[model samples]
Target: MTGFEFIAKAFKASYTDIAKRLNMTPSAIADWASGRRPIPKDKLPLVSKLFRIDEEYFKKKELTEVEKIKIEINYLERLSKRDTEQIPDTYTDDEGNQHETYFWYNPHEGELRYKYEELAYEELVLRIKRILTHDFALDMEYQRTRNHFHVVKELTELLDQDDGTVGIMEFEDISKEEAQRRRNLADRVNSISRMLYFLNGGKLHAFGKIDEFDEELFKLLRKFKIIDTKLPKKLKELDDPFDHRL
Candidate 1:
């Protein structure tokens, strides 16, 4: 069966239901079914996971006639939903504009700090390292070189906070020293973390050149099949959430 149809039927969800889950409309789902619209790469992972199908199946150029037949049979076994909800809209601010921000509760710090932006997975990791290094340096509780180890621990705690989720950061006007301190701390943390990763015998090539780090990391991840197949299993075995690396 075609990957999309197979998944829809297996979930026992209608096209409408599938659309709602993917933040698409029922007609959009139908377009996918009819091959009228191309499936967006960003959504493919989510669709594969939701439908419990191999991601590679959806990456194929086209389905064979036999595959189409299998898909139809699967669809026949399921019933359509009577109602469906629209997906929520995701928005971004205009250039040079500011927006309201919110933050998760920091029990240890005893404060709620506003977030900056909705950071991607890689960005989130870097930001966590940045925050931890600043916190450590400011407290004078850790040696400069030992910041990485401390960062990993602090990050684990911060991520476990109830409000921890995919989010952004917001900044306010601050002294030059404060901003410089924050940047310096973030840079050190990032450097140390990379060194630690290499020391652990993990492949450092995945990180690519340190200059274009984020894009390189994402590209390396896409080149390897490790993330979709292996990382999830590793994540499940880890007791500490932050111990799982991207």
Candidate 2:
């Protein structure tokens, strides 16, 4: 059963009541129930929490390691398709600088798909982080923006190397070039920053204040379903906890 159906059954509520609570129309809730429309990721947690159900239980399936890898590959395939379809033809500007600009038939749909892919990537990263922390006993610490940028940079570097094997080789022996490539790949994968900003009802600003940074990051974590990813003990001990804040 879909999450909406589960929630409706568990709460013993009418579709109208659930719709009112979710700020959606009854038809929308019924559509989700009937699989006529997919549940938007943002509302999944809210529904789960309201119903007091384990969030993971509402997930489509328990993704295995192999399945996770396959998902990443699928994301790459989608990215390739998007790039091929949306990217503009190369042209030289007045300054003699050649550049390409992507054109999209539906820019909004493109943005939505990009965010969906980013959410998948973030889920994989969290899984990897969990494995590193629990299985390998690494002294891993999650610092949201700080740690995410660091890991993205390192992974990008690994993926860029000519002879480097970022995912193929052992993490310790990954070459500098490979690390760079991996970092770049991760950055691209995480480029849903714009989508997160839009979803949070904020405009993309070149320079953001501290409050904006916090809100943006929280929105990103919520969008990617990574709010539960373990944080550093210090951050975890803060007065304003990160868990479930979104």
Candidate 3:
């Protein structure tokens, strides 16, 4: 039997009587009775004690397959939230050194600065997807003025070298295979960035119109069977102003 059914049978109380006794609205009681609402944890103990029912009666039952899947999806969303959180303005390192990080947000001027040093390629891709789905996704002012493309460009530069160097600055060395894996990831990110740039109406250099970058991205998309495989036709239709820099 459902928890609410058990509660009613044990207490010999109508839904309205239970609502009045618990200081809750009758609709809430009805919701519980219909299994439209799960019993609040704090109310569980009161339910058990007042009705002299076993606490186990109110305990959550084994989840169905669909319920299990929902729980798993919620857990994965929580994990993603941790990674996609905006970088704080300032933070202290484990070594006790304090550092000020750049995290600008000026809606009036249409600007947003995002720090991406700690983000992995997978997380970055997710962030790009979220950005694309934002209410301001098609806003030309927000798209062109925002620092999103700048941050993505920086990430591409970081993936270029074996030592994770951006410019002349070097970091710890990684294996050749690992370096190539990063390059491949960077290529994916670069492809997404280019797509965004085009969608945002950015102008492109004439000679830079159809380059290796577009060819690579086009091939990648075709392999994944996402959009149309024909690059030139798609570009011509969009009046494709490709910006290879981003």
> Compared with the true structure, what per-residue lDDT tens digits does model 1 show for residues 1-246?
445655455345798888888889999887665557767888878877776556776655566433433443333322222222333443458775555554433221211131121122235466656766576547554555466566566544443445553132223454575457546645755664654454344453456543456334433463453333223342245435564344
State residue 121's C-alpha deviation in candidate 2, in Å.
38
Q: Which stretches of candidate 1 lie over 4 Å from their true place?
A: 61-246
lDDT of 2 by residue, 89-175 (tens): 778999999998767543234333433444555555665586545544434455444555665554454334343333333334434
Extract clashing residue pairs from model 3.
none
What tens digits encode model 3's per-residue C-alpha lDDT throughout 204-245? 343276776765555455446545424455454654356332
Considering every candidate listed, which one attains the maximal TM-score?
3
All candidates' TM-scores? 0.25, 0.23, 0.26
Best by lDDT: 2
Candidate ordering by TM-score (highest first): 3, 1, 2
- Report every candidate's CA lDDT: 0.50, 0.53, 0.52
Sliding window of 10 residues with minimal summed lDDT for model 3: 107-116
Worst 10 residues of 1 by lDDT: 110-119
